[model samples]
Target: MSRLLHAELTKFRTVRGLVLGTVATAALIVGLGLFVAANSVSVCSKGTVDVECPTPPAGPGGESVRDKFYFVHKPLPGDGTITVRVTSMTGIITYPPPNHDTIVPGLVPWAKAGIIAKRGTTEGSGYVALMTTAEHGVRLQHDFVHDVAGLPGAVSTGAPRWLRLTRVGGTLTGEESADGVTWTRVGTATLTGPVEIGLFVTSPSDLTVHNGVGGGTAQARLSTTTATFDNLGLTGAVPGGGWLRDDVGADPEPDGPVHHPGSAEESAGVWTVSGNGDIAPLAGEGPGTQMTLLGLVIGLIVVIVVAVQFITAELRLGLVGVTALTAPGRARILLAKAAVLGAAMFAAGTAAAAFVVPVAERVLHANGSRRPFLPVPDVVTLSLTVGLLTAGVALLALGLGALVRRSLPAAGLAVAVVVLPYLAAVVGGLPAGASQWLLRVTPAAAFAVQQTEPAYAHVIANYVPMAGYFPLPAWGGLAVLAGYATLTLVLAGVRLRRADL
Candidate 1:
């Protein structure tokens, strides 16, 4: 067994394709590492905040502070009044609403509106303020619930119970509780410098007018209720953890001039950036970014090409018969060859991935926007998954090659196995029953391993409509692909054992 393993390894190294594949893999991994390291911002100095820390580069918004940290400010529930005041180093009160008619007076122009209002019949309103000598812009937003359905005939039950302010380097989270002792985390905002923050409120639901009328209908009147805020407090920035900050200036204003429409920067925050800007283009169209359907097409082509090379080159040269005679056991020779082919296919597939992924990313970045790319785990897992699937599919091709002892029919069958189900899925769509289960057995199922989005799960689930169809969980999708691979290899093994190759 050791000798066979050593021989197998030797064969792999001697193969020119295998050697090139290994080099390609190493180059990709190193290139990605360097790219990330060059682009990442270093936050921690001496394991703590450096009071004399040098200013970071201008962020997307051309702001000096490029990140933000947040801490929570808890306000009590129910109808109440609260006033928060912020005083700057220059004696300017930067923390309040812009004016009395507005929510508060003298608050930072860009600061987000942070308030924790209760649901039910009451109404709430508040304002926050910040002061900075540095030309910094603030953004205020109401943190609302996501993805929850409201009751029938009721307006959206979603309420902003938390507030988050974000800047380049820091963040703050505020939660309101009935008793301030125990507070729920409502939301958090990031900040970059020393700024005064305050919470202030006015008005309850009682004063709200429905459509500017006293005798408005009940449905219209429901919009009149508002909650007043009270008991505003401020806490110092917490250590280490902070809000994810982006280049505020780089972000396009909703009504502002258009820059790079649908650029890569727009997609930056969607994933976590790694060491630097080395990104993978999993979402775009390229050889690497081609849809799963395309991958299936490519995989089929690979199997046919390998099968043709194996059958014609070795059989026409009479090597198969000689090897079978020397081994006496046809099964052992076939198994040895299968093992060699599997290793070669795996190395080739991995090499192809390494070669294609980085180039694809660069192309996408160039065509789109410039932003940091998120890191995916090393190619080890991706390589293994693809290798296993390819090996299984290859074995079936090898078996067909042996059974037909001809290149043309085997290639045609291999292509059909990969192409037919995809064609069926496209034309008929995955039917709502056992037919969908049949779809999973196709090569497309294996490609689901490459998906990086949760939404793709829904797409895949809908693609295959079965009675018990829930889109396979990430791991489940991989397993389904593996199961198909295993079945193909098993059938190939059975054929190899019986056939007189």
Candidate 2:
């Protein structure tokens, strides 16, 4: 096996074209990425030109802070408790332009509807809530920006769900229940707010991208969400007070110009608030949230093309037979090739990512936005993720090359299998579900491993490719790609062993 590995490495090293292609892929990863950043500086330079752009620091995943929600509250300078029964919550899903059609399943997984006690109506105000989410069941969230998952249970329309938030001086405890009788403590936070208490419902305005022959923009289809609250019990704050309403994060005179449109209504013993925007730390799309990955997309294309040709070239040139003759076992030859190519791509990917990501961040900061709010570890993790993703893509391409058994056609098919799906997700302007579906099922899903943005349930943004929102978590998405590569490689090996050489 060692001799076979050595012989295969030698064969690869002797191929000047393959070696150069690998180098070029790496170079393009860094070079094209930097170029895209430079271009973004020029275009998004007309970016968020606001003095308040830098404050409220970026989210943990490098997203701009936003706090947009409808509020119905009267000031509580001291301790208080707010409870409400969320009777039902529902909304609609819409597609992008040309034909804007409303669809069902209006609720995305993390949409929130329930009761909140906030410092004030302004965004970034400290707050806490016991709410029924669209899919996460129940949760306790505070700071108007953070989430705390509740006990394992389901909460939905026609489901009897109740939430309670009690403030004891600075300590706040959130509790939830199914029957409004037995309370289960979800989580707690410490806050001293001139608390505003009321019912709130907000959606992330989930985006479905559409890509055509020309450039594409993401269309955010917002569900006109409605959440019913009954048995409204509030202590320490006067009841029947007029609710001073405003879109907390949507500044009419924004830090820049972001739409902050929301309304609250009280009727028939239930208080309902419908919010179209989000309730997050920041108001609108700032420089930190805006990202351009055209170069990386191109780099993905180049990398996969080269990786496919790496193996298909051997088969095309009849050199695979020579390898079989020398290695004694076809599996050993294939394994060695995979290892060699994987290493090469990994090294190149790491170098390119480390340099390009920092450059992109710095360029954006220099162009008028603040730097990405990523810790050193997160940045390093992102770089490593990209490096590992390149390795994964290389392996995927190699497997496809082996399956097709021809250089050009294999490379083309490789692009269709991995790169095309990825391209569609990024710019295809397809429904959010469709785009995410492609990423989840295709080897290209591995690219999601590089996402540094976190999708906060309350924060409203495009939540699409432009904002770096992928459906699956980073490692989980990589596993999907790895699974594809593994399945295909196993099949290819079986074919190599049985087929006529």
Candidate 3:
């Protein structure tokens, strides 16, 4: 077996064209990665002058987040509790779908109105809120990423919801009640020091989805929500001043009003609060590791061709027969060939991915791409993922070559099953569901392992393949591709044992 392996390695080395092809493939990976970074430019303007966009704030978990809402708050020096009964929630969707001409009274699913005990009035501060959502019922959210579901219903005048948030030392507890009598603890968060306790309201942009040439498109229109809160109660040490109103994250307009402004008012022991924008983890597209790894798609095609030809070249030259006679164990010979090819591709792929990722990231930032709010995969993880992906594709190609006993057909089959499906899902005109289906079932699913952005149910956006989301988890998708490769190799082994050489 060792001799057979050595002999196969020798054959691979002696072929100058094949060796050069591998080198060229690695070069292509790096070249295309840098090219993508170079071309990805984000430009912002203020009036007629160009301006650099401000970096987004980091949440408690260091993930990028959107923290904008209307707060009617008072400073509490220490431990405190704030409670409010939310009687009604209403919103307007501007220029919705179909005609896109008029604003309608409605609410986007994530519209939230609640009582919060935050570290301060600052955006992105650690806070916990027991809130009622437009569609998701009662929820307990903290720090941006963490969310827990509470009761299951919307708020109305007849069916009001009671929300309470309390802080004792470092622990914060959230509770909700339908009748303000029996309180159900929703969740807890850890935050200490002085905080601002208040009533707050916020709504995300109204998304209008449309099917288009490339899967679909989502247009975000400005939207706002108003919440009517009565029976407001507070506990613990508080300042003597009246409630302060601040529209966190809202920019001042030319006319001095808040841009996409939020409002706060008190009348006869009742508070009406209205706000625009979201107070959650940032969703949708951002600069991702995928930007650096774009070259892998083209590089994978080059690898498929090289891997297919590795075996097919031997078959074409009538050398496989001579080698089979010497080895006697046909399956062992095929396995040995696969091991050699897979190892070589793995090394090249890992090196290329590792080198390009950081380099491309610097380039991307220089070109004004937004810093990724999602967790970026580390260099080692990215390298190993790409390495494993390359090895899997190479083995599959080799198996197909062995089964078909021809070069072009086997290479074509490998690319059709893997590369085409990937390209189609990411860039083709297929519907979002169809794109997700392809990524789930096809060998192209392995590409999901490269994905850095994950879908969050709490943050609604286009979770489509084109928007850098996959239906399957990263390793799960890789397993799908690995399963196909393993099965194909098994069949090829069976064929090699029975077929005429």
Candidate 4:
């Protein structure tokens, strides 16, 4: 078996066309990665001057995050409890379609008005909140990405919601209530240190989703929310100071004021806070690792050709019968061929992905793109996933070659099953649901392995194929491709052993 494997490897390296095709796969990945990175540019006007857009802040878990809101807070030198009753939540949405000329009172479903205990006033600081959203009822959110559902109802003047956040040592507990007396523990988070505990309000941009061809499209309009909080209460080692207001993470406008600045007002112990932005994982709207790996589709096509040739070329030359006599077990021969091709493809794909990931990120950053902060380990994981994806596709193609016993048809079938579905999902103008369905059941599902940003139910964004969110998790999607490959290879093995060459 080892000798057979070695023979297959030797044959693989000896074929100039096969060797060149393998190299071309890597070349295409890197080439397209560089192209996309170099072309990406982001600029914003600060007053009359155009400058590069600021990068999003990294959260405690190291993911890029949007953490901006209006806070009416005071320093809590020790563990403390802050409570507030959100009497009303309202918002303004500017220029939403059709007429595109109106500033109207509304709330983008996720708009939040809450009480929070935060490590500091900085963007992306560790925090916990018991918040009432416009449509999602009460929620306990912590560390920018974690969200726990509490009471399920909208907040209004008539039906006010009471929120409480308490810090006990490193643990923060969130609770919610309707009448401010019967509190239900909403959730908890662990974040130690002195914090800013206060009343806060925020609203993310209103998104108008369009069910367009090739997945859904969305447009974001500037929006802000105002929440009226009465019956504010504080307990536990509170310092003597007035409430301070800040628009955390707001970008500076060109007119010298903070862009979309949030404001807070207090009158007769009641506070009205208005703010724009979100405290959530920034996804779908930025240049990500997926963009750098976009070349994989083209690379996969090259791999299909090479992988198919690995098996079908021998059959085409009528050399399989001679090889079968040497190996004796035809299935073993097929296994040897697959092992050699899969390994080579894995090595090439991994190396290309590893090179392109960091290099393309730097290129994108240099070109002023909104580059998300991905940890080194996560980057390595992505590269490896790409490698595995490449290997899976190659194996699938090799099996198809064996099954079809022809080159063109096998390569075409591999692409039809893998690459074409991916194109339809990402570029074919398929509806978002149809695109997600295509990605889930097809070998194209493996592309999910490259998605760096995860779709969060809490974050309001276009979570679709074109936006790089997959219905399946990374390894799960790869496993789907692997399952297809394994089944195809099993059928191919049986054919090889039973059929007369």
In candidate 4, what are the lDDT values of residues 1-501, reduced to their tens digit?
988998888999899999999999999999999998898777877778988788778899888899988888888878778888889988899998887988888899999988888888888899888899988989988998889999799988789988888887888888888898898998788878888889888898888777756555788999999989999999988777787888888787666778878998889998889999988988778437778887989999999999998899898887877887787877889999989999999999999998998999889878887666467888889889999999999999999999999899999999999999988887788877788899989999999987887788899887776777889999999999999999999999999889765
> For each candidate, what is the lDDT?
0.36, 0.70, 0.85, 0.87
lDDT of each residue in 207-320, candidate 1, tens digit only: 111221211211100001111222333333422333222222122334565322111111321211111010011111111222211333444465555644554455566675
lDDT of 2 by residue, 1-501 (tens): 888778767866887877887778777777766665666543221245434344443433344555666666666778878888887776666563556663665676556788777776654556777778777788777655677788755555557698888888888899988888898899998777467776777776775544442224546666556677789888875656565675665545434554546667778887776765555554324223224334555666677777777778777777778877766667667888888888888887777777777777777666655544467777688778777888888888888889988777877877787788887876666667777789888877876765665665545455565456678888988898889888878888888777545
Which is the better candidate, 2 or 3, if ranked by TM-score?
Answer: 3
How well does candidate 4 score on lDDT at residue 480?
A: 99
TM-score of 4: 0.95
For all predicted structures, in order, the TM-scores are 0.45, 0.69, 0.96, 0.95
CA shift of 489, model 1, Å: 3.6
Name the top TM-score candidate: 3
Q: How many residue pairs clash in each candidate?
A: 45, 19, 0, 5
Cα-based lDDT at residue 182, candidate 1: 44
* Candidate 4 lDDT for residue 283: 70
Instruction: Name the regions of candidate 1 deviating beyond 4 angstroms.
Output: 1-296, 308-321, 369-380, 403-406, 419-439, 456-478, 499-501
Q: Which stretches of candidate 3 lie above 4 Å from their native place?
A: 47-49, 254-256, 373-377
Which one wins by TM-score: 1 or 2? 2
